[model samples]
Target chain A: MWDKRSDMIVHEQDPFNAEPTPQVLAESDITPVDAFYSRNHGPIPAITADDWRLDVSGRVERPHVFNLDEIRQRFTTHAVTATLQCAGNRRAGLIDVRPIPGEDPWGSGAVSTAEWRGARLADILDAVGAEDDPDLHVAFTGPDVSEVATPPQPYGSSIDIAKARSGEVLLAWGMNCQPLPRIHGGPVRIVVPGYIGARSVKWVTAITVIDAPTDNYFQASAYRILAPDADPGAAGPGDGISLSTLPLNCDVLTHSDGDRVPAGPVTVGGYAQPGNGRRIERVDVSTDGGTTWNQAELDLPYGPWAWCRWTHTLCARPGPLSLVIRAFDDTATTQPETPAAVWNPKGYLNNSWPRMTLHVT
Target chain B: MWDKRSDMIVHEQDPFNAEPTPQVLAESDITPVDAFYSRNHGPIPAITADDWRLDVSGRVERPHVFNLDEIRQRFTTHAVTATLQCAGNRRAGLIDVRPIPGEDPWGSGAVSTAEWRGARLADILDAVGAEDDPDLHVAFTGPDVSEVATPPQPYGSSIDIAKARSGEVLLAWGMNCQPLPRIHGGPVRIVVPGYIGARSVKWVTAITVIDAPTDNYFQASAYRILAPDADPGAAGPGDGISLSTLPLNCDVLTHSDGDRVPAGPVTVGGYAQPGNGRRIERVDVSTDGGTTWNQAELDLPYGPWAWCRWTHTLCARPGPLSLVIRAFDDTATTQPETPAAVWNPKGYLNNSWPRMTLHVT
Candidate 1:
């Protein structure tokens, strides 16, 4: 596994958390399979496509079990090109503001886009005779157990039924038109576009339709945004805002922090993703510490759920320079100017203005 | 009309644009029909229910005309309690930052919630055999014509077919359980809950399914967000972002700009709205210019599309004091801190932190 992802930046060894370099992501529209980010809460479970089984139960009228072949044969296949982002993407900025111990110090590489193909969760719900109730939730649980919880338990998360039945959510088994790899949930996983990546359970084994959000630690307590001073250790279930869809975010991917560049015309670019179905309307690049701004050209997104790649050519002078990028979604919502404005104890959803300093020669 | 709305703060007399007092809005969840804000573009059309006709055509399998009685009898009636907000609801804040000529300086009272009873647009689209295409748009036109456009054309706008068939869009005929008043689009109107209020065309005369967004000035250019320095005079059709789903916003509604208050303990409250289907997660009240914040208690919204009422008690000293409020939607998005951060030439979507100063004695 280490040899295969040698080109990526490995953050942890046991759970195999790794991400591709920023230039690798900036170079392509659809992220390459090996270069795609891998974020796991537990050791990768060993399971073959033929031996994997999916149990659909709970409020569903016809509770049934299906092998991998049955899932592929019974439901119609649909493809969606969506960008999945970890809620902790760009968490390094928050950690720099203050100490966020025990959290991954992500640095703008935990997000990537891919062409996902699979059976729609809505179709599966329809096959199982699921009722259309907004109050209900579709919970997904995986076989991999992680000690991240106080007591070891299978990793689980859930999305509201309306999102589950939106027809865009999928139980995907293929990535970039290739068979899903073992490291990325080979048999099957849930792909909830527009939501934070944690909700898209990898190695998904059992799906249950419940009346409320799943009581799993990830769904009920862990991935929430608490007050800045609130102690996460003392929080109970549903303590803070349960993060779902993402907010407008953009990052400068070409130049790493403290990079030295020749003082002349240089290209600066990055990727921007607007939450839910909103489109990236405009991207403003500020070379003079946000006192002056130039609009960057945005490439049309592959789909509503995909990210837009933006580029701009800036004329640099001989000295130190500050570069900041912010995006406005179609809804006219822009990002906060600094990470401190959005910093939390968990260091999640750091959608502040992405900045980098370049020493010009 | 003025007699009926004596309690409202009338902005325009001819087209009858007016809004209620903020205290009036804060006092109730469901705005009384008489106190509801009335925003109009042109002179109200005098059409009785018996003679009013709805012509449904354009890109549909069947084109038909329906009378009010036919509309009431042919489809199932649904009730949705939704907040309708003007894109210019908080334009006053932007205007205070800079001069925004030729625009109404609206305060925070331009948004209100009411229970609307109507036929679902999805049902209407189904009845007309409209295809479910994401690229297509459903255009709506009304008999009232506004002179705001250079050519003085009838007010018109369009929403994408996905939003049109989302089951939340309605052809509303009732407001707060009463027959819609003439000034408020008497016989029938298109009620797009989550969109900018301009898209909800009143006195609706025609509904057309089109291949692209409507060419009407409102849809094509007027409601768009242009660059700060971009000359509006030189802008063409399809320029800037066409305003649609609202951004997350909150407003302090209990006191006016210069109200004097007793020192010691005072209660401050406001309304917060999360865009589209998202709910208001948390509201923060700052008594000393955002340096410190106290979480305001949020009241349950009437529906997903409704606004959440929030309030907080503050201890004040005898001096001039500034209060600022910001809201976090379930998506973890918050308002910008200052009006200058979001000021545009058009003075739309000033969702910056809502602030007011008072002389505490």
Candidate 2:
């Protein structure tokens, strides 16, 4: 039924997992909503904007239900241009270092940037009862179900309440100046800026303030990177090598791996994103395995949560290219050389150096 | 053996772990060397300036042993006014929430600021082989041994080479315009600015460039916060947490907790320190459980690694005063409300709000 665009790579069919090609991504500064990557864990719940009701309960002063129009009328709306990246954005890169990860073989296409307009989560929560009594975590529950479950199960996760009230988190109802789409957690969803995409629950209907972390399987069990020898696919509760905020990463998107390019002056470029609201300090590009390097020009003035696009021009000889690119965030943490350097058993936080091999003709 | 200071709370018997009293700490802008806190894991090793030799080895293009005189002669001498805090500085605060931590019952007296004069660590490492070959870590070995160490095991730790080359780290031979003393690291020791005091590696004898982390007990085992039930006293290797930098924190230096003072027109003051090279942005003080917070005036013109002193005037009326002070760093992270909020097993990062109660007469 998802028939708007057919040019993207479809990794899954039922729940719709796909990403646009690198050529399409480099064509513009802000990725258009249609060409943006879709990483859905379940089938889209076709709930209308009028029918959706947001229920906030648990330890709050005011346990109330809010419709879409009421939420908009009650709180002042704000817009934020940010990037939302899947935790498994470059999961495919880990296979070269070790065995395949538990998730889909994700390439570099599982990230997208957009302008979100909605009420600040802190503002909406202020209307409720955070002032009367402080809580520890804010849990979000979406009305999506497991693929094999006979009865529908909600997808939920929690973030620190302090983070929720930080004004960056949003109860988003608009994306890219349009109504939120079902494929992208539409009608209503929560946008937790600067954290992993999993924490940004889609199709959100319930928000509960609790004294502890979420007990949902997606949060307490599935999202963590267990011990290196543990089986991630069958992970139990409470191992907790937690994967909450993303790490600094960059991807060389202009050229496909092992593709043949003409031996002459060529421009190689990609996108670099930093985690924990850190700015991208610098990105270095090397063609001969980092022996010598040149700084890539960063396309700046982007939002703090959006990715910085970097491009560098270099001449390619008629031999194999040992291209390597690394990014340093404002926090002084550098991107690892390869996926193996940061490999966990679950292979989460895959912010390693993304390389490309181009054979010159 | 331990006879230097007596007024402060002493935690250890041999190495003389002690912290200055709040009144003593608030006496002056810069803490006096004698009034400064001492945090030692072993007996202080007395090494004269003539006997001390600093060795540079491991995976280098050049390896040399330089005496104290040669080190001062070879490199340019610079001075930095910085603050150093032990990881378990406020260990006593943890017991209010959970079980008692495995370390000393330290109060809030383990931080002090000083002007240190030394040769830059970056300039020294640049001379001895990072240019010829690449390395990941720079391991620092101290001459002091633990009480139970059979063969005089030296305390050792490693830091990222990028951090070593950051230029703020120093191979110090002097402190506060005087020769480095045995109580501190001397005649030559590393001053790793912006990192924890543990990584500074007191009484440093050897600096080795390596491909991985240090194999010493302090580096591989003791410094991290384990699970709540884990044995911090006898920690094992590979727990994966290494506390390199301090957290944003503030401590009231003028008044001790539960100390009785005259009521009305009282001025409350404290010191604020930010972690990881971030400067203190603002200090917030509230005498009424944060219902209303007043911004405190901060003393400026301080180094990035040093603490910023803040003072505030408040009129205290009668009985029990619930005073809460918190600090915000430039990176936007703030101090937690209480120690219970961030209770770790080893009591490593005690950036919780340091409170003071005065029974006004």
Best by TM-score: 1
Candidate 1 lDDT for residue B145: 89
Compare the candidates by lDDT and give the number of the best one: 1
TM-score of chain A of 2: 0.95
Clashes of each: 0, 0
TM-score of chain B of each: 0.97, 0.94
TM-score of the A-chain for all models: 0.98, 0.95
Top model number, DockQ: 1
Q: Residues A80-154, candidate 1, lDDT per residue (tens digit)?
A: 999999999999999988889888898889999999999999999999998767799999999989888656789
How close is candidate 2 at the interface, in terms of C-alpha RMSD after superposing the true interface residues? Answer: 18.6
Instruction: Give the CA lDDT, 0 to 100, for residue A162 in model 1.
Output: 88
lDDT of 2 by residue, A115-226 (tens): 8889999987888876444458889998888663223357888998878888788999898898888778889888877787889898999999888888887777766754
**Residue B231 in candidate 1, Cα distance off native in Å:** 1.2
For model 2 the TM-score comes to: 0.55
